[model samples]
Target: MKHQTSQLEFSRPLQVDRVPRLGSVEKLSAEPKELKALAKRMKLPALHALSAELRATPWRGGGLKVEGHLTADIEQVSVISLEAFRETVSLPVSRYFLPAGAVNDNDQEDDADPISNGWVDLGEVVAEILALDLDPYPRKPGEAFEEHVEIEAEPKPESPFAVLARRKGD
Candidate 1:
């Protein structure tokens, strides 16, 4: 009888995140009060949608910029730009071997699912959304500002080991 063996290699395609960008810039003609109200309604949903889309993407590092200009008629239109790092997080391929006992009597074979076993979590995504010239168009920009505010806790006192190490003549 003759014996033969086969080898299998697994590769997973890398998924890239799509960053949002400003498509066009235009001006609006309305009163300051009316434009403020309109801008608020228009930008809030778009910002939220962009945030959700960013959360869904595989890549987590990027920054967003929003710029707005007011026209003589007191109309406001904003442009949003996004820049992403070209680097990618590459995942290594894994190899597996099957034992003789694991093979079926009918010449069947069992293979392990690579993804199911080797899943890894990179980390949570952090993004900074900034709006330019916000002093004039305060209403719309401030709506989403509170969500991004970070309240950091004060540092705790060092332990005895740290304190002793810092002491002179250790």
Candidate 2:
């Protein structure tokens, strides 16, 4: 039997709250080597293909809107959700250190620690999101995938000196 495919168009309304700030510039700055590794591991070809497909589609709207979808794969959805969580947690961490007023100063050192005032918690959240394993491709609308929560068996306490310490016997 031959299956005929038909195109369907629909519109939905959505409201966006102000995007949450995530992290401080100093905190959000991923090491160049680390980013390169992540990009390499992601295997750009699939992403490139997806980008081409998305680019071919027309997006309607200026500011923002929300819509509901009928299907989605849980694993893929989890990855996207985790990424959004990372952004939300990271952006504010970055913004907390911004100097008062609109003037932008790249070299200002106020010595005020925003982390002491709850910003550090975001770092932990980011770390947790990064730890999860997720599928790269998910069914577009409705789909099912296994969900696994891997609890950190041993939580490592944060240390300011840890950054300066070399690996054991290094």
TM-score per prediction, in order, is 0.14, 0.18
Clashes of each: 0, 19
| lDDT computed for candidate 2 | 0.25
- The regions of model 1 sitting more than 4 angstroms off are 1-147, 168-170
| TM accuracy, model 2 | 0.18
- As a whole number from 0 to 100, the lDDT of residue 31 in candidate 1 is 36
Task: Give the per-residue lDDT of model 1 (tens digit) for 7-34.
Answer: 1011112122222343222222233443
**Top model by TM-score, which number?**
2
Best by lDDT: 1
92-134 per-residue lDDT for model 2 (tens digits): 1111222123224453644222222111222222222332323
